[model samples]
Target: MGRLYQVTVVGFKGERVTVDLCNTEEQMSSMTVEQLKTKVVAKLKINTELSRISLIFADERLDDDSKLLKDYGVQHMSVVQLVLQVDGGRQL
Candidate 1:
């Protein structure tokens, strides 16, 4: 894990999912928000086709699957809030 960084993904229940994102001294190599979501799902053993995963950073929802994480101001060592809506879009 050389030249990597940590982005702490904290769930609604205060659960944490650690993801070691690959990076360089400059910017990230086109890491998309969807990829991060995938890692979160795998780490937490959540759904494969997650229709309920949400990544919130700086009080803003990173809803675009095609967008990069850095485009949403998600820098290294950032704390992203993960909200998994259970029971059909309800936070349960």
Candidate 2:
């Protein structure tokens, strides 16, 4: 069977956007959050440190080791938000 997941993309410098991805059961069950993070980074061309970013899988904080559709609690066709923390470009 195929699974549909809503992937939300957000960054400190850009507006939030959501994308949908379809994956097979095998693919969905085997992909880790870190792997998904890499995909997001690649698709978005994020050059900054990924450690500074927060990925909310289905509105919950995603564990780096958690799998996209297996370990993470995301509903079918649900939205997953990726947020990056920024300090408004000001130095303290």
Candidate 3:
């Protein structure tokens, strides 16, 4: 077992979820951004596509699915904001 990290995911309509993630640098680096988005959608019961979901931390938006969590500097007790991407390009 690896060290557990508490990640707070804030989504639309103020919906939030706290997820436990592995803190090992190697493990975190192996996980892709898409996997995290899927977990958030499943927890929030949101019927949204993975491509339309955006994860943000420290005011920086994570846009690459191929990037790892460690690449984004996600660590223990990190707060991530989840936003739904709309087609109109409107700011949320």
**Which runs in model 3 stand beyond 4 Å of their true positions?**
23-25
User: Please, what are the lDDT tens digits per residue for candidate 2 over residues 48-85?
Assistant: 67665667754678856455556776544545666766
Per candidate, the number of residue pairs that clash is 0, 0, 0
List RMSD in Å for every model shown: 2.2, 4.3, 1.8
Best by TM-score: 3
lDDT (tens digit, per residue) of candidate 1 on 61-80: 99998899888988778999
Candidate 3: lDDT of 55? 91
lDDT of each: 0.80, 0.62, 0.80
For candidate 1, the TM-score is: 0.82
Q: Give each model a TM-score.
A: 0.82, 0.62, 0.84
